[model samples]
Structure formats: C-alpha cells, structure tokens
Target: MSEYHVPVLLGPSIDGLDIRPEGIYVDATFGGGGHAKEIAQRLDDKGHLFVFDQDEDAEANLWGATNVTLITSNFRHLTRWMKYYDVIGRVDGILADLGVSSHQFDDPSRGFSYRYDEPLDMRMNRQQLLSAADVINQYDAVQLQDIFRSTEK
Candidate 1:
C-alpha cells in the first residue's frame, strides 16, 4: 500500500455490498485497490470484479489478483466499457466510492489541495486535457463560480 493512500469507510462499504460469491462486481474507484482486495478475498472462484481507475499508477496494485479485470479508464465510462467487456447486463453488484483519494491530496504536485502552493493540475485522469490550471486560467470568472457552486451542491 502507498504510504499516502488509506481506504475510507472500508468495512461498512464492503458490508453494504452484500457480496454474492458467484456474482460480478465493479469497483469504480480502485484508488489503491484497498477495497478491491477485500472484495476479492470474499469472492469465490466464480466471482468477478472489474476495477476502474483513470490513473495509470493504479496498475501497480494489480499484482496477485487472478479473477480481476482492471480498466485504466474513468468511471464515467463504466457502463460503456462494462458492455465492451461483456459485463453490462450480467453485473450483480456495483460499488463506487467517489471523490479524490488521500494520495491525490497529499501529493503536492497533483494540485488537489489549497494547503500547498503548487501549479494547479488536478486532472484525476492525467491524460485529460482540462486540468485545474486550465479551468482556473482559461475559464471566465462566472464559469468558474458556476462550476464551484454546482460541485458544492
């Protein structure tokens, strides 16, 4: 596990899933694979889990899992990609723990925090073109305010 990463609401989240051994599950936010690991442990050989993380670094966490499918893509494309993987209609459970991870906040270069003075680069998907810097520097003040208000609600 990365020193900066920590799973949140892990026990309660897994318990709420009410996992079925033969079912297929999806973890939309596979930050450090903490929750995915726990879910995998409870799954039988027939069970399947598709983990999605836009970050390429997440692949490093997929060492020993046998029945897992890791997708290096944003969760917004979950339905589309699940269908591509032949798991759209067969999905038995879906778990999405949304929001930024602890590591993102701790890493000063990621620019997710206001606590540190760094170049604003809060692209959860590093491959994406629109980052926090782009939003702040390019968007008009009204647009920025609108985004902030919408996200707050």
Candidate 2:
C-alpha cells in the first residue's frame, strides 16, 4: 500500500479479478498505483497490465514494474488506445477504482479537502481548460442544475 493513497478492498478486489499469471489486464484508474502494483505482481513476464490515469500526479507513484505499462490518459478512451496497442479484444480483466483517492482528498493544494482553505480548483487533470472555478462562475443556474442531476456522459 502506498502512503500516497491506500487502496480500498485490496484482497477481495484482487480475488475478484481471478487473475491469470499470463493474462493481459487493465487498471483503468491507477491513482497512487496501489491496485496497479498488486495487479502487476500477479502477472508474469508473459502477462501485461495497461494502467491509465488522466492525472499526471499518478506518475509519481509508479513502481518500476517490468510487466506494467502506464498510460497517462483517461480510461474513457480505452478502445482507441487498446486498438493502438493491439490488446483491444485480448484483455482478460479490468479493475477500476472510481472513488477519489486519499492523496487527492488530503492535498490542500488540490482543493478537494475542506479542512484547509485553498483555491477552488478540483480538476482531475490540471491540463484541462475548464475548472471548478470556471464552471461555478460561468454556468447559469439551469446549466449547473443539469450537471448536478445527470451522471451519464
């Protein structure tokens, strides 16, 4: 477990994966690499794990694992990238921990925790143009309500 962000349900989640030592897998949300590290350990040289995270901060937690490939991009584009890597149809398992990590919540600079006063920037990817401040300031009442109501893309 990383001090940066501890993984939730570590044992059961890996058991649920039913990972094959030689199988290919995907870690869709590699926050602090807690899950990714576990997945990588379960794989052999023949096996591979493609890990994805939109936040550049995730790169800091990457351990030197030979069987893992870290892709610094959103998992929403999984198909396109998987096709590019020629593992589109061969993936055996995928693990996605969608909850915000401890690191993100604890970092006052990220503006996620209310314990400390900071800028209202809650962007997962700092490179993105739109931000929490922009949305709150620019969006109208109806627009904000619509966003709050719908979870679908």
Candidate 3:
C-alpha cells in the first residue's frame, strides 16, 4: 500500500468478496490501490478488474501491468461507465471502499478534515466549481436554508 492511503479493514473486506479466479470485479473507490492489489492477486489471467476513482492523485498508485481498467470518475455514475466500458451486468463482484482517504484527511490543503484550519475547499473532484467556500460565502439564504433543512431529517 502507498503512503497516500492505507486501506482500513483490508483482510476482512477483501475476504468477504469470496473472489473467484475468473470472475470480473469492480473496485469503486480505488484509493492507493491497496484493496485493488489484493483483488488482482486473486484473479486468474482471464479475470478482469475495473477501478473507479474521482480523485486524480489516486491514479498515481495504480499498477500498469495488471488486467485492470482505471476509470477517472465518481462511482455515482457506475452504470454509465460500466456501459461505456462494456462491463455492464457482466461484473461478478464489486468492492467499494468509500469516504475520504488518509491522504485527503491528513493533508490540510485538501480542506476535508476539521483538524486543520485551511481553505474551505472540500471538493472530491478539483475540476468542480462549487466548493465549501462557495456554499458558505455565496449561497443565498434560501439555498443555505434548503441545505441545512435536508440534514435535519
């Protein structure tokens, strides 16, 4: 595992998959490729692995020699990417390790964790324009109210 992010609950999480040697799998959030590496290990030469991650930094940790397809997009659009890649319903298993990675939480510049008093820029994809700063400083009263109200229930 890369120092960028150490995958939590590594063994139990991967073991729970009950991986098949020739089955197709998806790692929805391939942070640091720790879990992905394990999944790849269990796969035979005919097996395939598809990894999805919105954050760009995570790409640096992916292995090039594996039969893994890395998609640079959020898992919310899993169906779209699956169809685009022709995987669709062919996937035998999926492993999603969600939430902020250690690299994002530990780094103050990412502005994800409250431990650091950095810029209020909490965007998973940096390409997006709406940030935490924009919500706090630019959103209208009605917009802010709607946001707060949604969390109340």
Candidate 4:
C-alpha cells in the first residue's frame, strides 16, 4: 500500500553493506527509506544511520526513525557534510542508490519520462535552475551533442 519507491535488489544491496550491529552507516540516497529502514532495524541503540536526500518529500518518511539523522542536501557533498556532522572517519558503511526514483519518473509533472508529454524539467532537486528544457534551449547543437556523447561511456 505504500506509494514510496521500493528499492531494487533490496536484500542483496543491503547485504553488500556488510552491516555491523553497533556500527555507523550512511544511506546517501534515502529515497523512500527502503534501505535505511533495513539498516536501522539491524542496528542497536549504539548504531546510527545518516540519510542524505535533496528531495523534501523524503523528509516525511523519516519521521519517528530515532536512529536516523536526515541531511537535506545532495550526496555530492557527502564527505563535506559528514565532516560537519563529525562522523567522517567513524563511518562503518555508506550506501548510495543512484538514478531517478520511480516516483519521479511516474509523476508527469517531474518531466522525466517520454510516456508523458510534460515540461522538459528533469531536475531531481527541484530548487536547481538548469532543467532539461534549459539545456535543449540554451545549448548549441554541438555542445548538446558532445554532452550526450560523453554519457555513452
């Protein structure tokens, strides 16, 4: 019944973390907290889970998770924030689920999928200025082609 994105390869993904009961962990992309919940459940009172998510919608799902400390920022600055929180070197494991969530692709307004003819805004972080529309409209054909080609690898 939960509308949240169900994390792919849930068991194997978390297993790869090699979770320790009293260790500190980081869920770099806490979309729907699917993996975070599993990580939290395995941890005892001495353990901690730091969740980083740029999406504000994810904040609602984190409520009541006593062991979790939600950081509302992009994971690209993960090391910076970890240092700010003073958990830098103490971290036991870090898990990052990259790529757009199913929730983003399913929502027509988010403008990710070709299935829906919506605006060309494809920013996962809604606060960002550069959108898909901006790239297409602002960039020259050569620049755009070069950008696309780089991602092929």
Candidate 5:
C-alpha cells in the first residue's frame, strides 16, 4: 500500500457483501486490498474474489489472499474486465467504493492534491496520458473552467 491511501468504509462495505462461502465477489476498486483482505478471510477455499485497480502500486497489496484474481485496470471498465477474466455476470456481489484513495491524495509525487507543490498529474492509471497537468496546461481557460464546474458535485 502507498503511504497516502487508506481504505474507507471498509467494515460496512465488506459486511454488505454478505459473502457466501462458495460465492464469487468483485471489488472494483481494490485500493490497498483492505476490504478484499477482509472478504478473503470470510471465504472458504471454494470462494473467489476478483480485485481490480488501475494503479500498479495497488497490486502489491494482494499478499496472503489465497483465491483472488487481481486485474490491473480502472473500475469503470469492470464489466469488460470481468468478462475478460471469464467471471462476468456470475458474480454474487460487486463492491464499488468510488473516489481516489487517501494515499493518492497524500503522496506528493502523485499530484492529486492542489495543496501540495508538485507537477499536476492526477491519473489513477499512471499509464494514462491525460493527466491533471495535461488538462490544465493544454486546455484553454474557458475549457478549464468548464471542466472544474462539470466535475464538481
């Protein structure tokens, strides 16, 4: 796990899954795998958990889980990714904890926080080309304002 990201709503999220000993579950945002770890503990040898995280660092957190299949991709592509993994609609439960992890915001190099003085680069998938910097530096002022307004809830 990166020093900045912390799992949130972990207890309620895992409990809500109501995991079956032999069921299949998917954690679409497997940041640090904290919730996945808890789910794995509840599963029997026959149970399976599919985890996905676009960030390469997140894959390092898959230790100690025996029956989990990890995928390196964004959760937005989950349905397709699951199909690619051959575990599509058969999933008993799907957990999607949306938003960037605390680690991403805290890590100065990740450039997720405006409060920090670093290059603007807030990409969950480091492989992606459209970074915060790219958007800000390339987009005109009007476009930047539109992006800010649209992204705001």
Candidate 6:
C-alpha cells in the first residue's frame, strides 16, 4: 500500500538523476505529483518539469510552480508531447511511477481493493466505458484465463 502524496523512492530516485538545476525533466506518470513536486523544487527558474497523467483527477494534485507543466494526457504520447514542447532531445531525465497509487485503493468508491465491495470500477480513467466490473461480469472463465495468460512473462 504505497502512499500517493509520498513518492515511492524519493531520495534514491531523485539522486540517481544527478539533476541539473537548469535541465529539463519529465514525470511520465504524475499520479499524485509527489515526484513532480520534488523535481520542481530542485529546478531553478530555467529548469522545466513536464508531468503527464491521463486521469483528470490528477489535475487537482498539481502545484502552483512555474517550472512545472501539467499535461492532461496519457504518458503513452510522451514523445509527441516532448516534440510539441520542443524538449524532445533536451530532457535530462525521465521518471515513471508505473503502479497503482494508494489514493485509488483507499477510496472505497474506486473499487481497487477487495476489502470494500463497491462497484469494481478499476479504471485509471473513469471516462472509459470498460471497467473491472464489466470484465468480471461479462467475461467468461476462459476469457479471463486468456487475459491473465496474456500478462504472463
């Protein structure tokens, strides 16, 4: 159960970058803006941090830092966004926290953890019609097995 506001590996991860005060960085998965906030703090006025998250709820976590640019889109289009901002080849480092945040699990309505038996809407983007409930209720046992197998290494 990782905390959302608290970054998973703040110090080690940030330290590994050897961040330049005036360099550009990208937070590809800005779940709660924890990593982005840390990066923004390290950046000088010349530095820029571009953070991306598809879930509209992530927008609320954005800080009022001039160095931080919140992009309301999935990180899958990272290259496209970088090109649009003209920072494609200039990024000093990229950080991606690719895991479900505790913020989602703790919210009973989100239906991430099974402890709360709510509508199983395990979607990072609620705008999507497909949901965990739809998958479980509609998908046959064979279909579920196939899906599970697809995720195997």
- Model 3, span 7-116: residue lDDT tens: 88999999999999999999999989999999999999989999999998889987784689888999989999889988798999999997889988888989998899
lDDT of each: 0.87, 0.90, 0.90, 0.89, 0.84, 0.87
Clashing pairs in model 6?
Answer: none
**For model 4, what is the alpha-carbon lDDT of residue 36?**
91
Off by over 4 Å in 5: 1-4, 141-153
- Per-residue CA lDDT of model 1 for 40-121, tens digit only, reads 9889999999999998867877857788999999888988998898878998888888888887888898998998999889
Per-candidate TM vs. native?
Answer: 0.89, 0.95, 0.90, 0.91, 0.86, 0.89
Worst 10 residues of 4 by lDDT: 1-10
Ranking by TM-score: 2, 4, 3, 1, 6, 5
Best candidate, TM-score-wise?
A: 2
Per-residue lDDT tens digits for candidate 5, residues 37-131, read 88888889988999888999887787856799898987778889778878777889988878898878888899989888899898989889799
Span of 10 residues, lowest total lDDT, candidate 1: 1-10
Off by over 4 Å in 3: 148-153
lDDT of 6 by residue, 1-153 (tens): 225556788888888888999999999888888778888899999999999888777888876888999998878899999999999899999999887877888889888899897888988888888999899999999999999999895
Q: Estimate, for each residue in 1-153, the C-alpha lDDT of model 4 and write its tens digit.
A: 247788888899899999999999999999888889999999999999999989877887885978899998899898998899898899999999988887888889989999998998888888888999999999998999899899999
Please give the TM-score that candidate 2 achieves against the real structure.
0.95
The predicted structure with the larger lDDT, 4 or 6, is: 4
Judged by lDDT against the true structure, how good is candidate 6?
0.87
What's the residue-level lDDT of 7 in candidate 4?
89
Candidate 1 TM-score versus the reference: 0.89
Give per-model CA RMSD.
1.9, 1.4, 1.8, 1.7, 2.4, 2.4
Q: List residue ranges in candidate 4 displaced over 4 A.
A: 149-153
The CA root-mean-square deviation of candidate 3, after full C-alpha superposition on the true structure, stands at 1.8
